[model samples]
Target: MILPYPFPLDIQSILNNKNIFRRPPTRFGKMHHTITHPFHTPDQLPMTNQRINHEPVFLLASAPWRESSLWVEVFSRRYGRVALLARSARKRQSELRGVLVPFVPVSASWYGSQELKTLHRAEWIGGWPQPQGRALFSGLYINELMLKLTTREDPIPELYDALEAVMRAVCGENSHTAALRRFEWTLLNRLGFAPDLFHDGNDEAIRAEETYWLTPENAVVPIEEAERFNPRNHGVAVGGNILIQLREGDFTHPESLGQSLKITRLLIDNLLPEGIKSRQVLQQLQQFSFGV
Candidate 1:
């Protein structure tokens, strides 16, 4: 069986002097309108915006819904995390199948008062290139973090901007490591879970030569000063230089990368007790050389 180029255009249509699809119905009234899009607008942007369109979103996850539709999770600037039901999106001629993919910047219009909004329409907002290889996994990891840590409808505009910027940075092979660390810090900070990296638990300025311990209670204690407080558990111990590097936010020192990972891993897992599956996937992928 074969399906033609997809377009959910209405039956009634007119051709201009150029014989183009003039004012073809773009609204999502019914799911039966099946037309191929061998010739469609550039980047698959809807020829018109007859419905409510919000900020561009990144598709986090999508799955089959019924026989012809799809249930998707997306992170947007305005709405944060949202679940959408895209009707007739699985039809061979439907235009949304191509746009509702992970990592793509999509302009999506939806409506509903319930937790799941009905997808009115979608279009690919093409501009930046998608991540490939390990960066791709890193992208998935970010999506998972958004899903697990972020609250639905609790819009964090700054976090959205940070995410969008990191998405672009991760496209570069070597930049993914630095970009992921920066994004992780931003996420933790936005969620109010990040500690004051600049100041230690003792409220003293961290010196580069000292050794510090990160307590389970989210405080940094210098090893030399720990005897004064007689704290029971000092938690993971790290050099003061590593703590300072984390504060720098750039991970300029080669050692900061690994130390940053250890620090963030401990902190994030404490928040997500169920664990991040994407993180596990990344760990497992370490055995294989994708040259990324």
Candidate 2:
């Protein structure tokens, strides 16, 4: 079957479904088509006046706004990813200033009807420890990935849980690489574009002794078949055993973590837009320090 260019990956649709055991759907044998911008709730309510009820949320990202108000983006357990205007948060005297930092859990309340919601109250959860150095950067990378991949007001409770787990791992001083790999694998699977690591395009199960190549549109295949259908330059070659382990999310296996790092990098690079600064910074850091 001929594959379409610029695949949707149908991340949202997949996550919304309660059933995760079924084979996720695939798009193929079609002409190329461009996807339009997803429908956003810009017109649903004026961000400046609507009121959002208070609830516990994970602070994903925050930036300064005006003189005192800070523009914050949070992944709320109840409201999903949202934009909030935290009044006077940038002020040195504001209690909310330090409480809303990224990776911190906060109980936030807001009200607004405009495109930008206004923050009414924020209280820190206070128990979780701060992430340091590389873990901090890794947390930012996770936030960036969510911002780029998720839609506002769209809830992925499972993804939220995974994010919290990653934060916990980071806070407890676990290997950031393992944390990232697991979280990323879950994120991709949570979104519909999860790779079919255990099977070929023709529905045959892969053997552990074989070598394989993966393509964004075609899933996985034997290296020989991939070279015949598409040039070797177009795909990333990986070991079959790694593919099987990834299929099972066996991140504890030494090979799984290593392969996860490699495969996730390729997937993110292929999925994201060009000139993403985070990716550039990550590449430079890798060159200077090899592995994280």
Local distance difference test values of all predictions, in order: 0.66, 0.66
Question: Which runs of model 2 end up more than 4 angstroms from their true locations?
Answer: 1-51, 282-292
By summed lDDT, which 10 consecutive residues of candidate 1 come out lowest?
8-17
TM-score of each: 0.73, 0.76
Model 1, C-alpha of 1: deviation from truth (Å): 16
lDDT of 1 by residue, 89-175 (tens): 889898875677666578988876555667888888785666677777777788777765665556788888888878777764566
lDDT by residue for model 2 (1-292), tens? 1111111223233224443122223343232222122223235444445566667787655555556565666788767778777877766687776678666577888876765677888887765677766676676677767765665666678888888888877776757678778888887776665666656776788888888888766768788787565454456788888888786767788877877788887776666644344556666777889665
Best by TM-score: 2
TM-score of predicted structure 1: 0.73
